[model samples]
Target: MMMIELLKPDYIFESSWEVCNKVGGIYTVLSTRAKTLQDAFPDKIFFIGPDVWSGKENPLFSEDENCLKDWCAYARESDGLKIRVGRWNIPGSPITILVDFTPFYAQKNDIYGQAWCDFQVDSLHAYGDYDEASMFAYAAGKVVESFYRHCLSKKDRVVYHANEWMTGLGALYLRKHVPEIATIFTTHATSIGRSIAGNNKPLYDYLFAYNGDQMAGELNMQSKHSIEKQTAHHVDCFTTVSEITNNECRELLDKSADVVLMNGFEDDFVPKGNTFVARRKKARQAMLNLANKLLGTKLTDETLIVGTSGRYEFKNKGINVYLESLNRLTRDKNLKRDVLAFINVPGWVGDPREDLIARLKSKEQFTTPLEVPFITHWLHNMNHDQVLDMLKYLNMSNAPESKVKVIFVPCYLDGNDGIWNMHYYDLILGYDLSVYPSYYEPWGYTPLESIAFHVPTVTTDLAGFGLWVNSLKGRFSELADGVKVIHRTDYNYSEVADVIKDTVSDFSALSAAEIKKIRKNAAAIAEKALWKHFIQYYYEAYDIALRNAEKRLAL
Candidate 1:
């Protein structure tokens, strides 16, 4: 085999819908890895995002009116571009530009027409946020092209990386307008794959039999799928977050990934020694106090605080499986110790439960259980919610008679959920164990975040993180290794639930020293996943992208 020479870019521009916006898992991927990229390139890296917070305060962004002063003025005059330059409030504090794409909506048709003419991207069947996301993407590409023309020399090597299908238009636009600039398009998850899974179809079992274009049309994903497939085929490099997602790209996008860019995390968000202990203690106390007040029964420290949290995807995130497992745990007559399962998934909550708030404020234990004690907050439609319906179906009333109690925290834990009044990390540190039984996770971050905080977690083999754990041990992972890789299949929902119940029962029965050892091991696993260790893969990706760009330019 001939040896491959490594190449690097002089400048890198990464555009995503989540750059300054914290939407989903992609935000975690970019924010946590920003510091590592900044250390290597200094001020050479720039992040492009949509300017949603035009006149409002964006806590994640620290705007600087003078950071890109001359370029901003020149671009506005020459290209009609609207932008705000700032530093993202992440570890790396990388330079970020939030583009105002509102003005471009009027010209969406012309832009979509050009995209179809140049790259064969089919936006004719677009609906909902498809037009909005494409406008942002097109605006981002324009921003990069204008900046390159005004600031950089033609001889300089540059790379433009767009993340997810939402930004596929940007990558395609960059490749068309500035053919000299290399481009990398990463699909964290394919549109058709997600649609298939979300609609209760078996994505994995029937993956090989499905045609990308045919499925796109049948599933009403034509517009997003067309752009993603075209960008993947046209870009200098195509990448995905994991081996599992790469397979999805091959089967659904008709393209094999140039690289599998595993997501990495920074440990700077975790608190240090004494602070960590203090926060954990405080979190546990608050959790127990609220449980006591809501259920009218005092829960001791020894009660196993189990949790499952993510987007409210009833099936995709395995919320149904998790609840079913909890339902089983609640009725297990042999289970001796108490287990408090918290569903921290945010929903359409209206306000905090006033009765629970009043009870907590009075510093008095309630003699009677509050009405509808299962949820911490008041939801917009409590009667019609799916989670509530499931709980009702399981008859989990969190009464004084049950050995296991389940609580629903239906609001984001951003230090103002009105109950915990703590950040998610602070609140999650209180959990003795976390469970993430995902059905369609491209790269699981919640489980990784749990282990990072020294909380042993349960995840299924279907998740990328769970597969990584299995790779380390070459067998089923157990609680002793800081994780339990439960064997899950498309049809093994009940089996997975049984496994989770058994795992939690076994964990609750462990001795103090054994639990401490497991916690230590969990932290060690997180150490292996830090950005410092995983940054090397990014370097590998950058090299592949640059070398491919060189070959294209040569032709």
Candidate 2:
């Protein structure tokens, strides 16, 4: 085996779905990874993304008025795209560029515009049809092409790393024009999986229906499967967030990625010791209060507080599966433990069908005035007219148990809702067990973050981290009892409920000595899986790309 030296590229361009504008795990990866990239290859790494408009003027770009104008003009005239270039001065390193192509983004009907919008919408809070998204993607593609052209002439060996299908277009564009340039494509999650999980559609119908040519022409109509296929086929070297996504690429796109680079955590930010304990205690107390108000019974310390938190879509994030498990657990007569599930799923109340169903079932509910108001308010906001229809529909099915108090915290919480929401750390520390059964997770950071916080996690095999965990099962099994990996495919509602019941029961069975040991082991595992260790992989990936490019040059 050859130990490759850290030969830094003359210039490195990283285009991610989220850079300054963060909507998901990619944002955290880009933001935290920047420092490491800079430290390893100072003044060489450049990050490019759409210049999302901010209410306040950016000081970074404001300082470089003339250079920014010159770059913009050059990009427009030479590259044939409207581009805004902003620079961020990284301490002890090269400047990071924030690429703004809002003008191109505004032209949603175009090919590049649609692509940009599709990527940004995944991170943006608001939701709309695909016209805006299609235009966004098209504009993004144009802007990326312009940026690549602008940076290509610079005297360093150019290394381009594009994240997800959204930015993969840039690498594809480069490959067509400059085949010698080192291009690496990273698929966070496969489009096929995401679409099937998100859109309640059959896999075959979604995957085979739309091809790249067809998708490039139509904005929102093309399936995610097509976008992923295009990404894999075009990039020079392909990388995925986890083994799961790698497998997905092989299965769906029939193209295997070169590497599996798992996502990682920043340890310094995670709350621990007194801080973590205090927050957990506060969350427990809040849950107890909510339970008392709902079931009219004070929750005891012995009560197992099973927590599940994520963005509020029931189908994709596995909220429906979670609810079914909870329903099954409540029906278990043999189960001895008093279990209470605290659901921190945001955007649930906004869903019409689910909200209507919840409201209808509440009529026979035993919840108190305080609890009722909160639940009803959430329901009303979600769908006012449909709620009445839901009440009528629930007359047929059994009412949800009052014991399993499902408290809906509809808004985004920061340190106030059971735990601090400092991106990853705060959210992970809030629960004893974090449930993430995502149907389409490119690379889940929640499981890793949960383990880091000494909080146990249960994630589906569909997730990237879950696949990684399964690979390290022997190591994980030895580390702690805190984390539990469940194969969602193996179990239905009842089986999942049994597993949840057993896990909670086993957690209760643990002695104080046992719990302390589990926490220590979890911390150890987290240290080994930190972002610092993962940063090395990025350099290695670049090395691979460069070596291949060099070989091509020699030939």
Candidate 3:
């Protein structure tokens, strides 16, 4: 078949569950990339998402009745869609539609029936988030349909992009109803692939052996996987964030992406020069003060603060591997500096420790460890918490004599967690290193954000970002190269842990000049991953979708 001519989009309608909501890595991907797209297309790009806040204020959304007043009115009076027109309070402040899908829940069965008929989507085994997300997506589709019919013409070159399995229903809805509009579907991570890895199964080693439909049945993921699989097949263009996920899509979804839209980020949030130095100094002081009071250990300002943070996925996010590596580092005799490793993953946090709070406020110093000095916040299920359990299993007591100490922060650093009253970005600047030895990461924003903050990190070959770094460097990447990409597999847990231990220990021994150079190198790598560079892949997707849409319309 002859390749279709590439086309530029006059307007773009992108939808994701995380558009204005700060959910997972998708928020970072969308928010950071928004500026680039906005600059390129001016006021032609719009984002659509679910408004789950239910009347309470969301800091991320700045509502403006004037932004899309006409469409908002038409959507309500004509199409009966409940939506709030606003600008997402990010860098570009892109125009957005926050749909209230509450009313759509009443017609859930009808919507599901239509989906089954139109796209052969199987919602028979639907449960949990399947209904809720589908309703939101279905409402979004109506919102877009109303807008396209109200404002756009058939001659307009437009692209309707939906993200993740959560928005698959919307993409399929558009394909069936508005075939004139080009459509793109991006699966950030395959539902079945995530289920396979989350269940502690070997995904990569046995990827070919595992049948997606069979595994979906066995794992009770028929609904989510079905929508994802069908949407990937039905959309004009199917894309993923990275090569790792593209491979997963081919094997699990049985369709390779037309293009791999590698998640890129900007550094407008990062401070520079003397301001950065001062902020880092202040951040380090705050962390040290908290540690000194909570653990009753006289940790100096010179302590190497290394941390890892994300959703509390013990194995998937490699929290287990990270903790095991920290345990090994504590025993390494070659370590020349005090390393303060922080497990920053949030859990079922109950509240901040009252005694720790008192100590943070007081100038009075103490030499005795507080009760459960290892964790900053109290978990709802203290005895059953996985991080605490892992600490106990590893015999990590955070003893004052040990050169390496671990602190588990089981709360989101959203400026008011009682302790560490700063945003994650503000506080994380003080860290010397970040590690994400993920067992299964489609495209890790943790390490990307880490390096963007100029903190060199150790990640695994399994992560999409790690593989990208390897491609940039060619040789085996090391901490000196701004990233250390450790080779990891289902069975190489011990080797990955040992490599992390040795790398961190060696890092602690690096001279000040060498460390500064490594930090510079890391930031340079981040520059290469900016949206200015990665936005081309998105254009490629738009081209494919537009060309395919034309062919379908002709057919």
Candidate 4:
């Protein structure tokens, strides 16, 4: 049952949003999976990210100033980039560093402008700006470059595994300077697909016609195609979170990667059996109350509540698509099932509200009761204007009868409500079915997390998880009705409706016994896919890189 001892890596350098800092799914991947790497590689694995400077206003860093300063100096002198390295006394962990290089901030700003500056500031804020996407990638690259330079001078035989485009620049920089050093680039999600999805434009038009390259250049970041092309041509090896991303890179960037390492979930974090039963009961009750209050309907135990939650980006994360599909499903008399859609998307200040208005308009046309809550934050740090604008849009739109309620929970609930819950992994373990119709997902962690909860998940072929799920469908089907992969080839309203209708219809007929069987199968599959099994992939990748370096040395 120990499926992870297959590949062992020496000196695995994982640069991601995780470890001490977190931004999105990339953070989850690194932090949740770090212990597994440490267990497999011992002190050989190094977790690297920007030494986020958060000590000024916070008491957390005030207590550790002296140590932070000393470590910062050592990191700077050692790496030559105002860097800082420190270790948390966690067991079986690598030397974690909160790198501080504010001195270099101006230089980066001169190159990347205020966008980068805004992103850096947002990182310190309680609620991060997901749209300020470019800064972390550039900063992470700088960290990697500095780390690689420091390691090289010490004659370290290391395999540099850079996560996403943020750290891909480090691998590229190292390859140019030290070709013998092994380097791998992992693109969790492509910039091109994200832009297209978010902007509601065609990928080709977004890349070539629209001024994406020009805009990115102004920010000192590479266009999606350019980054993929450069990483593919230069790095010792190129990997992606999912096979879908791999194919996208190959087709879109005209370059091939060496591997497609599917993303995974932490088995230890997921609640199981009786523990999950209690949590599920609470979540179900909370959801029902909210649904009844908003939709004006008493949801029965048999009412199917299809849940979807993530960072609230309208087009790209498929929020708009999901809403449109719900509108259509509710309108279809034949498909008129007592289904409640729990959308757990938190509103961001700069995020577009126009899409929300459009969805509200469509929901007005629906006859079946719909309950939609647009969650907002009341905290002082939140953008007041954006919240007001969202409220304004909602007020101006035609309100459906209380049957279709749009409740805005403005306070932060730490996963108590099924919607806008951070601890969705806990909630999903109790879910009958989870839906992820992402227009762009590098390697989605939700589907895998759902699988771990023994919940059948619906993901798109565009996601990295979808690719892996498709690969393991036969194996998983034997155990239970594993993950269902939907094709996201079109983004038109009609097309999205068809996909959602098909998915809901297929899921509706599942017998409770069948669902239980599938849940068991999903858990078994997830057990094998845990970090324990694949942390070695990092080590093995490093070994390949080091071996390649040695062969080059011989030549």
lDDT of 2 by residue, 1-555 (tens): 996576557778787656555566786677656777777777577676556654556433333445446656777787766445545533333344454445544443454433345432222222343333333344454554565566556345778888776665556556555656787888887655565556664432345453433432333424344555665765657788877666657766678877677777667666667887886676666555555544445567667666776666566677666666665555555555566665565553442233334433453433433434324224444454322233233331223344344544554554433222233344446455567766667677766777787777777666767766666665434225455666655225456556656565566567668867877766766677777888767767777787777776677
Tens digits of lDDT, candidate 3, 403-489: 888999998888988898888998888999999999999999999999999999999999999999999998778889999999999
Ranking by lDDT: 3, 1, 2, 4
What is the C-alpha local distance difference test score of candidate 4?
A: 0.57
In model 1, state the lDDT of residue 276: 95
How well does candidate 1 match the true structure in TM-score terms? 0.98
TM-score of each: 0.98, 0.76, 0.98, 0.73
Clashing pairs in 3: none
The reply for model 4, stretches above 4 Å from the true place, is 1-10, 56-73, 76-84, 87-93, 106-156, 176-180, 203-228, 293-297, 332-337, 349-422, 474-480, 491-496, 505-511, 551-555
Evaluation by TM-score, superior candidate among 2 and 3? 3
lDDT, candidate 4, residue 128? 28
Measured by TM-score, how close is model 4 to the native structure? 0.73
Residue 393 of model 3 has an lDDT of 99
Tens-place lDDT digits, model 1, residues 445-524: 99999999999999988898898888888898888999988888788899999999888888878989999999999999
- RMSD to the native, candidate 2? 7.0
